[model samples]
Target: MIQNRSLARRGAAVVAAGAAALVLAACGGDGDSDSSAGHGGHKATASASASSSASASASQGQRNAADVAFAQGMIPHHRQAVEMAGLASGRAQSAEVSKLAADIRKAQDPEIKTLSGWLTSWGEDVPAKGAMDHSAHDMGGMMTDGEMTELENASGKAFDTAFMKLMIKHHEGAVEMAKTEQADGAYGPATRMAGEIITSQSAEIEQMNKLLGKD
Candidate 1:
C-alpha cells in the first residue's frame, strides 16, 4: 500500500507558517540590536549580517511549483537509488557493480542533504525518510517491495543482472524528472542540480546497459 505524501507536505507547510511569526519577531529584534555597541557587539552584528546574506544568496532565485515538485519527487527517488546501491556489496558478482554502488552513494548522499537543506530554507516540506507515496507522487522508477525482496534474496550473477537492469530504469526516471526541472524550475540551484543529474545519470545508464549486454 502506498503512503500519503500530503502528510509530509502538510508538515512542511505548518513549519513555514510558524516561521512567519518568528520572522516578524526577528525583524523587531534586528531593530533593537543596533542600540548595543559594547562587548564586540559590532563584530557580532557584522557576523550575523554576513550569515543572513549568505542565506539570502542561497535563496536568490524565485522558487515555483516546478522547483517544489522536483525537490519533493527527487528526494525519494534518490533515496531509493541509494537503498538499491546498498544491496550491491558482497552480493554483486561484478567488481564494477560494487564500485558503481559506492559511486552512487558518494554522489547521492550529499545531494540528499542539499535537497533537504533547500526544502527547509524554502519553507517547503522535506520528504520524510521512511515509506513514501510512490503512486501518488507518480515517481517514475521506484522499486516495489517484491522487487526489492528479489534483489535482496539474489546473489552472484543474478544479483548483478538485476541490479544493472533496475538501476538503469531508476536512472532513466531521474533523468526525465531532472529534465523537466531544468525546463521549468525557477530556482537557480534547483535547475543546476537537475542539469547535473541528467549529465551524470545518463552516463551511468549507458554504462549499466553495456554491462547488462543490452548494448
Candidate 2:
C-alpha cells in the first residue's frame, strides 16, 4: 500500500509539470504575437509618413492658370523695360536718372530670366524677343513705337525728362499687373514676387514724381 501511494504521488507530480509547461508555451506564443503586431504597426506608420511627404511635394509644385498668365505677361513687360533702360547710357543728363535706368535694367533682366524659367517649367512658351512690338501697343503704360523712336532721338535734358516720364508710366502698369497677380495667382513664389514688384516699383514711382517736381 505504501508503494502504491508513492506511485500515485509520482503520477500527480508528472501531470502538474505538464500543465506548467503548457502555460509557459501559451505565454510565449502571446509574446510572439504582440511583437509581430508592433512590427506591423511601425511599417504602417512609415508608409503613412512617406505618403504625406509625397502629398506635400505635389502641393508645392501645383500651379494655376493665373500663375501662367502672370509669368507670360511679366516676361515681355520686363524685357521692354530693360530695352528702354538700355538706351540711357550716354543720353541721360542727370546722374540720378542714369542711375535709375541702370537699376531698372539690372533688376528686370534677371526677372525676365526667372519668368522665362517658370514658363519653361510649366511647359508654356516664352514670349519671343520681337513680340514686344505688337504686344506693347495694347498694354497699359507701354510706349508706342513712335514714342520710343522719339525718345531714342532725344538727348541730354530732353532724354532725362522723357525717360523718367515713360519709366514712371511703365512702372505704373507693372504695379497694376503685379496687384492682379497677387490677387489671383495660386503659386506661392510668383505671388511673393508680385508683392515685391508692387513695393519696389511704387517707391520708384514716388521717387520719379519727386524728380519731376510733380510730387
Candidate 3:
C-alpha cells in the first residue's frame, strides 16, 4: 500500500509540473502576441502621421483660387501695359516718359513669363493676348477702348501727358489687384509678389502724379 502511494504521489507531481509548464507557455505566448500587436500599432500610427504630414505639406504648397485669378487677371493687364509701353518708343515727347515706358516693359515682360509658367505648372489657363480688351473697363482703372485709341493717336507733349495719365490709371489698377492678392492669396510666392507690386506700383503712381503736375 505504501509503495502504491509513493508511485501515485510521483505521478501527481509529474502531472502538476506539466500543468505549470503549459500555463507558463500560454502566458509567454500571450506576452509575445501583445508585444507584436503593440509594435504593429506603433508602425501603423507612424505611417498615418507621415501621410498626414505629407498631405499638409502638399496643401501648403498648392495654389488656391485667388492665386489663379491673380495670375490670370494680371497677365492680360501686363500685356496691355507692355503694348502701351511699346508705342512710346518714338512717339513720346518727354525723355522721362520714354524711360518710364521702357522700364515698365522691362519689369512687366519677365513677370508675364513668370506668371505664365506658374499657370502652366498649376494646370490653369493663361490669358491670350488682348483678352482684356472687351473687359478692360470693368477692371480697376483700366482704360476704355476709346482712351487707348486716343493715346495711340496722340503725339509730342500730348502723347506724354496722355501716357502719364493713362499709365497712372493702369498702375493704380495693378496696385489694387496686388492688394487683393495680398489679402486673399494662399501661395507664398504669389503673396510676396503682390506685396512687391503694391510697393513698386504705388511708387510709380506717385511718380506719374508728379510728372502730370498733380499733387
Which residue pairs in candidate 3 have backbone atoms (N, alpha carbon, C) closer than 3 angstroms, thus clashing?
A: none
Best prediction by TM-score:
2
* lDDT by candidate, in order shown: 0.88, 0.89, 0.89
Q: Residue 67, candidate 2: how far off, in angstroms?
A: 0.8
Better of 1 and 3 by lDDT: 3
lDDT of residue 4 for candidate 1: 65
Error of 3 at 113 (Å): 1.0
Candidate 2 Cα errors over 4 Å, as ranges: 1-33, 133-136
Candidate 2 achieves a global lDDT of: 0.89
> How well is each residue in 139-160 modelled by candidate 3, as lDDT tens digits?
8777788888998999999999
Clashing pairs in 1: none
Q: What is the lDDT of residue 71 in candidate 2?
A: 90
Ranking by TM-score: 2, 3, 1
In model 3, what lDDT does residue 174 have?
95
Sorted by lDDT (best first), the order is 3, 2, 1
Deviation in Å, model 3, residue 138 alpha carbon: 1.0
RMSD of 2: 2.7
